[model samples]
Target: MKRRWLLSLMAGLALMAAASAQAADPVRIGFAISKTGLFAAGTGSQFDTYNFWKDQVNARGGLDVKGVKRPIEFVWYDDQSDPGKAVQIYEKLITSDKVDLLLAPWGTPAHIAVSGVVERYKFPMVGDSAASVKLRELKPGNLWFTTAVMPDRFGPVIADALKANGLKTVAVLTPQLPFALEVKSFLMPALKKNDIEVKVNEEYPPSIKDMTSLLINVKNANPDAVLVFSYPADSTLYMKQARENGIAAPFQFVMVGATESWFTKQFGAATDGIVTMGHWSPKVAAWKKAQPFFDAYEKQFHEAPDYLDSALAYMSCEILEQAVAKAGLDKDGIRKEISTETFETINGPVKFNGVENATTPASLLQIQGKSMELIWPPSIATAKFEKKPAWPAN
Candidate 1:
């Protein structure tokens, strides 16, 4: 009788231990990012931020899941900024690694390619740099979400800025990509609505090495302002050439230049007064918690954080954490929670419209003196624009 009682007690203890261990298993998150290729800077910054979040969470005893803190395990794969490759890597993440959550890769081309796969897996993902409006055109599902400021949100704001600034004729240079197309679609309409004339419009291939000819042509056309759509490298080159060749346009800005700090660093004095459309800036009190984040990031990486990538990564994780806490760890439950969800983030308040598949009340910013300043929508403008950049300078 005594032996039997001891055996029964041991069995009960063992069962409870197993249950605890199972509950404490790490939650796996999957990331497909550009380890190499054209968009590496953006994706690389994103990975750095993600790792920072992972470290911070784990250091705090991991995530609190039903009274248990489980460490998060991220399974990352290099997408190489190739869409087909991104699709393949995503498949491995879903089938082999079996990640509990998904993250969008960098660059528009890769995102456009792998979005279908993410949708198929029914996973919620927010990318650091994939901000095209086309992502919302697909069928709305419970597991699909993004936090980046879509171009449509900024296009109208820019058009209004142009009209207000008395700039009527503008030259536009766009990259041949989905994001550029989406931006142009909104900007053209908004410019028309504001009665601003597009004097010179051109789209160049992604591989174009030299833009001297285009600059010369634009100089000849002599538009009031020049707006170029480009990534960091292209942006740096364009500015350097524009200055050296004496394009001397009082106004020049690149839509995506705001994402990387290198834009200002590379351009230095030339970048002193460039205007840009950005979602977040460190100067804003709205992201008060972000100062510690920025400090820690610089200490670890010996580099200042890319506000665009870091903020997006942090907000993305915040949304995932909220959804999981609300709906438990089950995939289906999290999916449902994300669909009807609305939340505030570091970049002000955000919500998926559930209709047009886009975000609203996105902030527009300009680089004034040495800092990014908010300039639009009145509700969130911390600082007004003093002097906007211009092209075709006298």
Candidate 2:
């Protein structure tokens, strides 16, 4: 009888241990993104998308962990698009608030600024920026990740698109930012390999208000195509000025114009012919997941999304969901889960190539009548390239 009583106690203790092990904690994820300054336009869209995904996941009974579910809660701070402030907020989330996960800021400068803090604390953070190859050069820790495509690989995609269209001579303009410059550096080498002559190359200040002089120089070069790389406001200014100056070229592509919707709404027909590299255009195959987000975003915010950055931020939230589900709401567990990606996202099958860059395929995109279309990489493309029927018509 004593032996039987001891067995019962042991079983009770074992059951208690099992119950203790499966107990869940409220998952608190933190985000530090640009809400002001130059990157605000991009980050604002990003923040909306992130919240959209967060709500969607929570509405579906939160994240599925093994066999149970837990709701997600996030603590966010506005980096204001300032690198220094980004660092401060990041520390606040990790050290003070002790959030379970960290989401980094937008833009390369801001990402680089706070990367060291993440590395030191060893907390998992996926940001909207850090697409540069340099981000991967940092010391290895499972704590950092991003969904931003490498800006360096993007140069080759641009060259390929231009080459396939039989354009040999082109003009390039880049903004004076780290990622933009990295794009130019990589693209110039690829253009050289393809024997594509760069008739004109120019760099403009980050926020060039009026680009009359620059447009005049580009017109003088008279290249067959032109590639413009700049931040949103500057990119918009350059395109508007290019049209006003009557510098028509057969092919005009905007490198960072993934947020083509914003520009098209403002520029109308002038935004018609711009070609861009997009991560999640409404036309890509992955839009199956994105369409719902897009519809909800437009209805709620009354604005179409800036695909690439917005998608990056949205996926950051989803990443948290997956990590929390696998790691059981602990930082160490979540960090391990993040280090290994096993599913596709709204942007398609996603796995971080390194701490800085993601390996998702690029979608070549164009604007068509208030909608964005995917035109290249045929398998995932939603439409064929239709040359802009206006000014620079072939």
Candidate 3:
């Protein structure tokens, strides 16, 4: 009887040990992201931020999922910034590589392409960059969530700023991409409704390099404000060309440049008074939670964080980590948790609205001195709006 009892005790211990070992196994997350091609510069910092999060989590002994600490592993592929390739790679990540969790790629087009696949597989995904209204219209199920503030929210802010500053007329330039088009769709009507005339509403090809003619045309129109909706490269080019062509407007806004550190670094005093939509800045009191993240990111990466991309990437990971912890290893549970819960991230408390979009206010940032300052939305404004932007000497 004693021998039999001892064997039973030993068997129980063995079972417990096996369960512990299984719980300790690494949790694999996968995604395809742009490492090259058109989306490269835009996605580069975002990708690095993800790596930074991974290193931080692992350094702390990995993610804690339902009381057990599981080492986190990422399986990623370069999508080369192509939507078609992103879709293909995401399919493989879900079916072939069998990643435990999935993350959305860099932009609206890529996210829109992969949304169906994520829904089909019922894999929960968090998008860091995509903000097109089309995503909401698609209603791509509850499994997908986006951190980017929708265009509708940002459009009104810009319109209000224009109205406040007494800018009577504006010229708008946008890339032909869905994201830019969506923003333009909202912004044009908003400007018109605010009694602001849109002198030149032009859409350009994404690959267009010669914007001199376009700038000259806009210069001739002589609008009070000039808004360029493009990515970093094109935005920078437009600003340089605008300066070179001596196209000075009372207000100049670019959708992409002011939020990036490199934009200021490259343009220096030239970036002064340039307005852009931004996600986060260290200056806002609401962003106090992000200071540690900024410090850690700078320490790890040897550069200041790009608020637009890096902040979004880090916040997405934070949400995923929380969801995984609360929901355990089950994909469906994580999806439900994320949909229902309000996640506390560096950007403050983020809760998904009915459409699986994170409800966060967008900030209008302007370059003042060498740093970007939040100027709109009084609740978080770090500085008053400069009525007339002080243009640099050509």
The local distance difference test score of each candidate is 0.70, 0.72, 0.81
lDDT tens digits, residue span 1-394, model 2: 9999999999999999898678655467787877777878766666677677767767888667654776667899888778899888888988899876666577788878888888778776666645777877876555354444476777787787777777899989888988888888988988998889999998988877888887888899988788888777777777778777776786777766546456777777777767776757654544477777678777877888777777777767667667666776566777667767654566765676556445667556777656777666666667766655555322
In model 2, the clashing pairs are none
Best by TM-score: 3
Report backbone clashes per prediction: 10, 0, 0
Q: Give per-residue CA lDDT, model 3, range 157-249, as digits (tens).
A: 788888887889999999888877877888888888999998998889988788998998899999999999888779878878888888788
TM-score of 1: 0.85
Which clashing pairs does model 3 show?
Answer: none
- In model 1, the runs with Cα more than 4 Å from the true position are 1-24, 287-292, 295-299, 355-360, 388-394
Relative to the true structure, candidate 3 reaches a TM of 0.90
lDDT of 2 at 286: 47
Query: Estimated TM-score per prediction?
Result: 0.85, 0.86, 0.90
Worst 10 contiguous positions by lDDT, candidate 1: 385-394
What lDDT does candidate 2 reach at residue 135? 71
> How many backbone overlaps does candidate 2 show?
0
* Model 3, position 146: C-alpha lDDT score: 48
lDDT of 3 at 202: 89
Evaluated at residue 150, the lDDT of candidate 3 is 80
- For TM-score, candidate 2 versus 3, the one ahead is 3
